[model samples]
Target: MNGDWLIRGRDGRLSVYQLSGDAVLCRSERGRGGAWTAPRTVGGEQKLHPVLGIGQGIDGYAHLVSWRPMTNGESGLVHSAHFRPHLGALDWNPVGHPRGQGRRTGAPAVAVDAQGRAHVFVPGEDGTVSLLAQKEKGGWEPWRELKGSSVQDCLAAATGESGRVELYATVPDGILHWRQQEPGAQPVLQEALQTQVRPGTLYALATSADSTTVFYTDVSGDLCAWRPGDEPAVVVASAGPGPVSAVRCDIDGHDCTLLAQRSASGRVAFAAYPTELESAGAWWTESGPQLSLDATVSLTTDDNGRVVAATSSPSTGQLLLTARKDEPGLALEAWRQV
Candidate 1:
């Protein structure tokens, strides 16, 4: 899955969503410190792409979006929302083609505003980014185009603590950005940034109420972090060729950022640093046995406020999860396959 595979609900329970055939399967923790339930299919079957985009709102609803093959040889985006923890998700709702009949060329990215409205961003074949957003009261507005060119598929979206949404995408030259001037307003295009990054590796994390930090692998296989208005990107650490997953948590009474990625050797590598303080440095530590290269890692804080990391077993397809130990620093428990 290209998007989020692990999600923490408002009730402190965690749910794991994975792609199985054309359907989306989910397994949730029964309760805090409880065993995870068996994998059960949630969203109905469809001709879905390998990508899955998940965004959660302050109301604890998880919005899901993916592309399905259309009859006209184009791709259409479908959506579903998960509200209750144990209950099943809503049926897949068609968001239609971003350009009416035009095809979606890349994976869709989702971000939920502070009001719990979902905004879906899709890239069209013409290199333009289209947005289909949920209205405040209910319903959805017509698809609108956000002007851009040569926009690559590495689209990232994050809603700031102020309830405004920000978007970033990779262009041939550098990076394109869009931000909402205020909550519930449309995102206006900002100045394009000059930086070379690998496509499909963009990930955004809202660091504060008004600021967001974006992380991605550079062309040289080094992980970097850049916030708006930052002149040069800060190199975080050397990483593999895949996307990275990160979450902010308190470590040893200090606010820190934890990152995980699949290394070139196929093992899960982890690193932690003081949040927004990359100059302090970080070191990559391998955790868990090596799996398939396609296997992705996800991170979230558990009910007890401990950092948890999860991935799927390539051979058994079982959900493998581990949590940070109660000790000091970034120690973790052994991998538990459920």
Candidate 2:
């Protein structure tokens, strides 16, 4: 999802937003671990998972988008919802609709610019990528093709200076492409990057004026990175062999990164980068637990520097946890079920 947030509750608890079944849920850190705010039906229809975003503007509005299935159980449309944490309720009753029915191959990818304008991306029924945007001043633009075919079902976004958003996705051939989008400016597609970003791999992005970096796992689950125009990707963590989860968040007013990859033994390969992330292996200096989480997990951090993860499994139930900062950070607080 596009928005990265500093969601602090009244008691200073941290919250992670997620979608369960067809509803929007907010799980917050409690005494030792956390508790779930009641599930709220933000979107009337959805299947699989929805992307989440919390605006950076003064409104602090939060957003969600999901693939709405048709009567035949196929994804035919995209639906979106809005919420405000200050009000503790959904502020908008209307769902934002994409311009048309879609094959819904990819989940909605969203990002909020410095100005609080939200940008959304999704794969269309015709094998092209669709782009939608909401203005910071208000109102949504009609959906339009951003161009591409054989695109995979994953998308990522990063906002840089000058209101530009860099959107990236992997095509079937294991190559990645990115484009720079600015409001009312001519968009230019960049040359394809040979990131070797495998199909079905979860990826995260980090951007700055100087460079933009993509982080993901290879087919064998070794962590990797691609820095456009600078150099070829380097393997950050050798094949841990499982699902990858990552997020850029803030702790104590500074940027922090959280990364997790499940190992072959069902234990999670997790690390926290307190400074700008460079060599990830060094953060593994402390020892901790081996664990597993659903591949579609999103990570966040509390003001306390504790990592909070929202994850799910069809058989084991959905989970939310705060990584123990003291005990080598491998030890998890008791997880609350979603």
Candidate 3:
């Protein structure tokens, strides 16, 4: 029910994961043109936190991560699950706390490299960033702390065209960035960039093979985008105080980026603009009915390349979805409950 609840598989099928009670439940499409199955439990025999971290690798598998609270009441442990479209999820595996101590302070953010190794990043209660990564041959390296301080729980990670992974975290003053020196290498901290970012509103989209642009709501509730080293962050539109979800797709043979978020008035808002051209401007269009102020919205491209947006109904808890119609401009089909 939190974090990114929607994902597209390598097979072009889409899957939605949500938190139900202490277990994680999933409803998935049979295939590109198939039907959706009923919701079923995919994780959580041990009690789990509501937050879920999901990342997809090049190999077409979705990696799920969550926190498992210990019975003794000490800091909980981190656990992970893996799933493919046809094959169901594997048993949840324990990924002990970073450095083997202290529960992660915020929802974990995961990024899988070109080699298909998943790297998990979590912010510590002490305001440090910790990383637990998969080894090439199979297995995990010890959890290590990446250089950071005064870090907020909201974090973002993505793999760029160079096949290296990059990470971003918000601090009291601005944002912190880190990137792999090379593919599969340990991520090294880059220069800290100063900007006023709202906590829990960071999202990263890989704009090109070598560059990734991070989007977030500023403290003033304006949506902004910044590609490290290219330019200062540009305001794209005004939005509510929540995380924004975006995906890049071809609209009428033109490359475009589509964004979705919960509006200040509680409706899901959609926007479209030329990719990397924030200065061109975008208009926010509210769609669907009002939702909980904290409800999360996710966007992904279907197999046919149509943009799909999804969010859970706060009142009924049913899944609601809408897709871009195959027409000129950014027209959408009616919202449908799944």
Estimate, for each residue in 88-179, the C-alpha lDDT of model 1 and write its tens digit: 88888888887676565788888999889999988777788989899999889888899788898779998887888889999988888899
Best prediction by lDDT: 1
lDDT of 3: 0.80
**Clashing residue pairs found in predicted model 1:** none
Tens-digit per-residue lDDT, 106-138, candidate 3:
788888888889899888888988898999888
Name the regions of candidate 3 deviating beyond 4 angstroms.
Answer: 1-3, 313-315
Better of 1 and 2 by lDDT: 1
How many collisions between residues are there in candidate 2?
A: 6
TM-score of 1: 0.96
- Residue 329 error, candidate 2, Å: 8.7
> Could you tally the backbone clashes for each prediction?
0, 6, 2
Top model by TM-score, which number?
A: 1
lDDT of each structure?
0.83, 0.53, 0.80
- Model 2 CA lDDT for position 43: 43
Ranking by TM-score: 1, 3, 2
> Under the 3 Å rule for N, CA and C atoms, how many clashes does model 1 have?
0
Query: Given candidate 1, what's the lDDT at residue 138?
Result: 88
